[model samples]
Every structure is written in structure tokens, then in C-alpha cells.
Target chain A: MQHEREHTLKAFDQDLDRLRALISEMGGLAEHAIGEAMRCLVERDVAGARRIVQDDKKLDALEIETERRVVQLIALRAPMAGDLRDSVAALKISGVVERIGDYAKNIARRVPELQDVGHLEPLSLLPEMARIATHMVHDVLDAFVNRDAEAAVKVAERDQALDDFYDSIFRTLLTFMMEKPNNISHATQLLFVAKNLERVGDHATNIAEMVYYAATGGQMTERLEKAGAL
Target chain B: MQHEREHTLKAFDQDLDRLRALISEMGGLAEHAIGEAMRCLVERDVAGARRIVQDDKKLDALEIETERRVVQLIALRAPMAGDLRDSVAALKISGVVERIGDYAKNIARRVPELQDVGHLEPLSLLPEMARIATHMVHDVLDAFVNRDAEAAVKVAERDQALDDFYDSIFRTLLTFMMEKPNNISHATQLLFVAKNLERVGDHATNIAEMVYYAATGGQMTERLEKAGAL
Candidate 1:
């Protein structure tokens, strides 16, 4: 019986490791999807946009598969306290990943709509925004694996920068719309894409916040601006 | 041991019943918040706005308390299968409730601005939108407690009406702003408030969809569009 208990513990560890790997894999696909979607926007790469849409299929499949594995672990093993938290975190992580997939897909769909806007005036900082979001996802996943609360805190802090970027985009788009009403249709589509990307960043921040809670057993509810350091 | 098992089962049932009741209470609070918020918008009721803002603290505390109880359940009972799903669902419901709280706050914050417009027209359907959302939450919570997949399905189907309402508000506000630019500030703020209310309805729809999956063990991805059809 003792040997059986030890084996179950080993299996539990293996399952959790695999789950984390699956989440990161899904995160990679979503990050790539966001990158390609924005690239399609910048370069008018319709084919790239098509690729992001197609790749969402795999993300969707993996989300379902990961959720099932988590469910199976619960029903099959009756997970204890910490394992329950871990499994619940996996479920929430899968949700955030799937939503990131949707954001990328939304950006991809808006690519064709922006074709007449004459190259989108470069959107100067949005790529940086996407990079920050991608890095947050990657860092949060690593932090989750290592139980690194400080890393999670750093990721959470970056949300203020993301917000600054979002506000800049809003101000810029509002000016573009007001100054050149003719550009409203094209510019509005771009605004939606940017907003979607920003929301993706928000989701990453949410995951990092969850990591903070999981790692430190403390809820980090204070605003990043109030906290002041990354 | 059998008596002990019976006692444990009874205690679990009591917790489940309490959780269901608390969610219903939170839902009612959120629904009232939404209604009063719209009243503030239409009537420019500063007092109503103040009331909504004050009540938001209650919703926030309810969410925190709900989460604490759900997490405590995980620590105390290594729940499996349906019990596990219910606990996780409780957590998810708290997320939706918090978001609803935010929309209410947005609506309340806009009251001082709405007073500036003085008899704006788009306020007509704004309350309807909030009402539909509040109804969806109540219906979904009922479905969850009763395991009524059909009720969940019905609520899921009505999602588009809310979106359609959103689109209507958008067009009305944009047209109003263009034709009567004096109302731009108020109209724009109301536009955002309407959008936030619409989003609350969407989250409620998401919860209804989750309840459907929980009750029926069906895949949710394929049904998002169909789920919009009440």
C-alpha cells in the first residue's frame, strides 16, 4: 500500500508537469497566432492571416483536450487540496489561452478590412504591445512551473505599461478618425484589432495575477500603478 | 463509518445549497445594480447613482466571500466529478459577478455626464439591455442549481438579442452625436455604458453555456453561435 501511494504521487507529479507543458504549448501557438495576425495587419499578408485562423483549430482542440485531462484527474484520483488548486489553475489557464486564440483570430479577420487604409501608419507601438503580452504569457508559465511569485509580480506590474500603450492607441485612433473622417472605416477596424490585442494582454496579466496567488497564497488585488514597481 | 459517510454527504449538500442561495443573492444584487444604474442614466438620478455605487461594495464583498467558501470546500473535501465541477463553477460565477459589478459601476459613474445631455433618446433601450442580462443571470443560476440543461440552452440562445441591442445603441449614439454634436460627450459615455452592459449579458450567456456543458457533458466550442439563439 505504501508503494502504491508513492506511485500515485509520482503519477500526480507527472500529470501536473505534462499539464503545464500543454499550457505552454498552447501559449506558444496563441503567441505565434497573435504575431502572425499583427504581421498580416502590417504587411497585408492575407495568407498569414489565413494561417492564424487555421492554427486556431489546433488551439481549440488542445484546450478541450487539456480540460478533459484535468477533469479525468479529478474524477479518477480525487485530488487533494494543493492538487485541486493546481488543477483549477490549469483549467483557468486553458481558458485564458483559448481567449488569446480568439483575440488573434479577431485580429486576423480584421486584416482584409484594413486594406484600404494605406499601410496603417505603422501603428508604431502595437508590435511592442504584442511582444510584452507574449513575454508575459511565457514568463507566467515559467513562474507557474517554478512557483516563482516574484516573477509573477513583475509580469503583473507590466500591465501598467500595457495600459499606457492602450491609451495611446485610443488617443491616436480618435485623432485619426476625427481628423480624416474618410479614414473612419479603415481606422475603426484597426482600432478594434488593437483593442483585441490589448485584451489579450489583459488576459496574460490575469494569468500572471493567478500565478501570484498560487505561488504566494496572497491575492494581489492592488493596481499596478499603486504598487509602482515591476 | 456509514453514519459518518451520511453526515459528510449531508454537510456537502448543505454547502451546495448555501452556495446556490448565495449565488442567487449575488445575482439579485447585480440585477438591482444594473437596473438602478440605468435609472440613473435615464433620469440622471444622482441619488440612484450614489446608491448603485454604494451597493457595489456589497457585490464585491459577496464575490470575495463566495471565493473563500469555494476554496475552503476544496481544502475540506477532496471533491470529485460533479462536486468538483460545481466548486469550479462557483469560482467562475464569481468572476462573472465581479464583471457585472464593474458594468454597474460604469453606469453609475456616467450619471453626472448623463445629466448634461438632458433627455437623451438612446437611454430607452439601455435599460432593456440591462434587464435582459439580469434575466439571463437569474435563469442560468436556476439552471445550474436544478441541473436544467434546457433552461441553460434557452438562455444561451438569447445572446444575439443583447448584441443586436448593442449594435442598435451604437448606431443610435453615433448618429445622435453626428447630428447633434452638442451631445457628443454624453452620447459617447452612454455608448460605453451600453457596451459594458452588453458585455455583461455576454458573460451571463457564457455562464449559461457553461451550465449547459456541466449538466449535459457536451462540447461548448461548436455551439457559440447557436448559443446566441434564445
Candidate 2:
């Protein structure tokens, strides 16, 4: 009986490790997609943007695989307490990551539209904004893997910078549009790209909250309130 | 043992009923918020917009409650197969509905921004767009409660109309902005409002997919492909 118990425990651990690996793979793809989409925007590389859109399918597949693994883990292992919560978090985070990938895809789709407007001033701010948003995705997934509630909180805090960047870009683009009405359509695309990046930041923070909850078994309502105050 | 099995089944059904009720409440709040936000936009009712923002917290609270109940249902019942899938679907749908509520709040936030440009021509189309989106939310939640996969599919199909509405508004607003640079600032707000409505449609479709999956235990990839073709 003792040996049997040990064997089951080892299998459950392996299953969890696989789940985390799938999530990490999905996160890496989403992060890469963001960078590539922004790069494509800057360089007017429509082919690369197309590739990013195609690559989103892989992330989608991984999210579905993650859900399958999570379901199997719960049914087979019946993980208790923190483990169970972690499994649930994994499920939710995979969905969020997939949406992050969609945002990247959305940004990619706009690349061809901005071929002429690539030199716009607000365009320059976007790569940096994308960099920050991508980092949040990276850091939050790391927190999830390590079950580090503190790191998760830190990641959640970084969203403010992204929000500030979005606000600045919004103002900059509005001015650009007002000054040059001909640029309205393309500038509008950039506005959405900025909004998409802002939403990516928000989604990362959401995953951070889930990670914190899974690790600490407490609601992050206070942290959210604090962040709101910021 | 049979009596105990029957008792367990009864409790599980009651738990599911509660889960469905919570989701319905969240859905209703989200749908109502969409309508009110659009009304506030047309009427220039900043106070009503603020009220929509404040009321979003209640939806958020309900989502958290739904999550808690789902966790309990999973842990205590240890549901198998379809029941387990339903529990997981409820978890995901709650998150999606919460986001739908956030989109409504986002629309409301812009209500104050558009105070000066309330009479814009494109503004007329928005209330109808919002109406359709709200109906989608209402119908999809009904599908979830009834486990009606066909109804869910119908709800998903309606998203195309929302997309069409968005496209027309996008063109109209671009022309309006180019004709009057002063309108760019407010026109941009309307663009985002249209985008928000489009996303609400997408989210309602997302919930419909979840409902379909929970009911049929099949992926919606084929339907997605068909929709993409559309």
C-alpha cells in the first residue's frame, strides 16, 4: 500500500510538470508573437506578420491541450487544496494566454494597413510598450511555475507603466490624427494596437492574480484595490 | 449505497442549478450595462455612466462567488466526465462574462469623453449594435442554462452581423474624421466604442462555444473554421 501510494504521488507530480510545461510553451509563443508582431509593424514585414498570425494556431492548440491535461489531472489525481487550485489556475491562465496570443494576432493583422504610416511618431513608442507588456507575460508565467506569490504581486504592479504608456500614446495619436486628418484611418489602427498592448498587460496581471491565488490560497482583492489606487 | 448514490446525484444537480443561476445573474447585469452605456452615450448622461461603472463591481463580486462555488462543487462532488466538464465550463464562462462586463464598463468610461460629440451620425447605429450584442449575451446564457447546443450555435452565428456593423461604422467614422479634424478626438472614442461592441459579440460567441462544448463534449474548431470562412 505504501509503495502504491508513492507510485501514484510520483505520477501526479509528473502530470503537473507536464501541465506547467505546456503552459510555459504557450507563454513563450505568445511572448514571441508580440515581439514579432511589433517588429513586423516597424519594418512593414507583412510576411512576418502573417507568420505570427499563423503561429497563433499553435498557441491555441496548446491551450486546448492544457485544458485536456487539467481535466485528466483532476479526474485521475483528485488534487486537494493548493494542488487543486493550481490546476484550476493553470486552466484559467491557459485561456488568458490564448487571448494574449489573439491580441498579438490582431496586432499582426494591422501591420499591412500601416505600411505607409510606419514612420508615425507614436509608432516609435509601441516597441517599448510591447517590450514591457511582453516582460509582464514572461514574469507572470515564471511566478506561476515557481508558485511565487510575491513575484506574482510584483508582476501585477508593472501594469501601471503599461497603462501610462497607453495613455501617452493615446494622446499622441489623437494629436497626430487631429493635425493630419489624412492619417486618421492608419492612426486609428495604431490606437487599437496600443489598446491591444494595454489589454495584454491587463491579461498578464490577471494571470498574476491567478498565480498569487493559487500559491497563497487567498484572494488578491486587496492587491487589486491597491493597484487601482495607484 | 444506492440511496447514497441518489442523494449525491441530487446534491450535484442542485449545485449545478446554483452555478447556472449565478451565471445568469452575471449575464443579465452585463447585458443591462451594455444597453445603459449606449443610452448614456446618446443621452449624455454622465451620472448614469458612472452608475454603470459602480455596478460593475457587483458583477465582479458575483464572478468571484461563482468561482468559489465551482471550486467547492469540484472538490466535494469529485464529478466525473460530463459533470466535471460542466464545472470547468462554468469556471471559464464566469471569467468570460466578467470580461464582457468590463467591456461594458469600458464603454461607460468613454461616455463622459463623448459629451461634446454626442450628436455624431455614427452614434445612431451604436444603440442598435448594442441591442443585438445584448441579446446575444442574453440568449447565450439561456443556452448555457438549458444546455442547448443548437441555440448556442445560433448565438455564435449572430456575431457576423456585429462585425458588419463595426465595419460600416469604421468607414463612416473615418470619413467623418477626415472631413472635420476637430471630430477626430471624439470620433476615436466612437471607434473604440464600436470595437468594444464588436468584442462583446466575440465574447458572447466565446461563451456559446463553451456552452456547446459542455453540452456535446466536442470542440468547436470546425464551426470556427466555418465562421472564419464567413
Scored by DockQ, the top model is: 2
Badly placed stretches (over 4 Å) of model 1 are: A1-6, A44-54, A71-84, A122-125, A221-230, B1-8, B43-61, B64-87, B106-120, B177-188, B220-230
lDDT against the true structure, each candidate: 0.77, 0.90
Supply every candidate's count of residue pairs whose N, Cα or C atoms clash at under 3 angstroms. 4, 0
Q: Write the per-residue lDDT of candidate 1 for residues B175-199, one digit (tens) a residue.
A: 7766665555566567778768877
Q: Write the per-residue lDDT of candidate 2 for residues B22-121, one digit (tens) a residue.
A: 9999998999999999999999899999999999999989988998788778767889878987998898899999999999899999978887664688
Per-candidate DockQ values are 0.22, 0.61
Q: How well does candidate 1 reproduce the true complex, by DockQ? A: 0.22
Error of 2 at B95 (Å): 1.2
Error of 1 at A76 (Å): 5.4
lDDT of 2: 0.90
* Candidate 1 global CA lDDT score: 0.77
Per-residue lDDT, model 1, residue B3, is 100
lDDT string, candidate 2, A52-154, tens digits: 9998989988988998888778766878888888988998899999999999999999998987653687789999999999999999999999999989999
CA lDDT of A188 in candidate 2?
Answer: 90
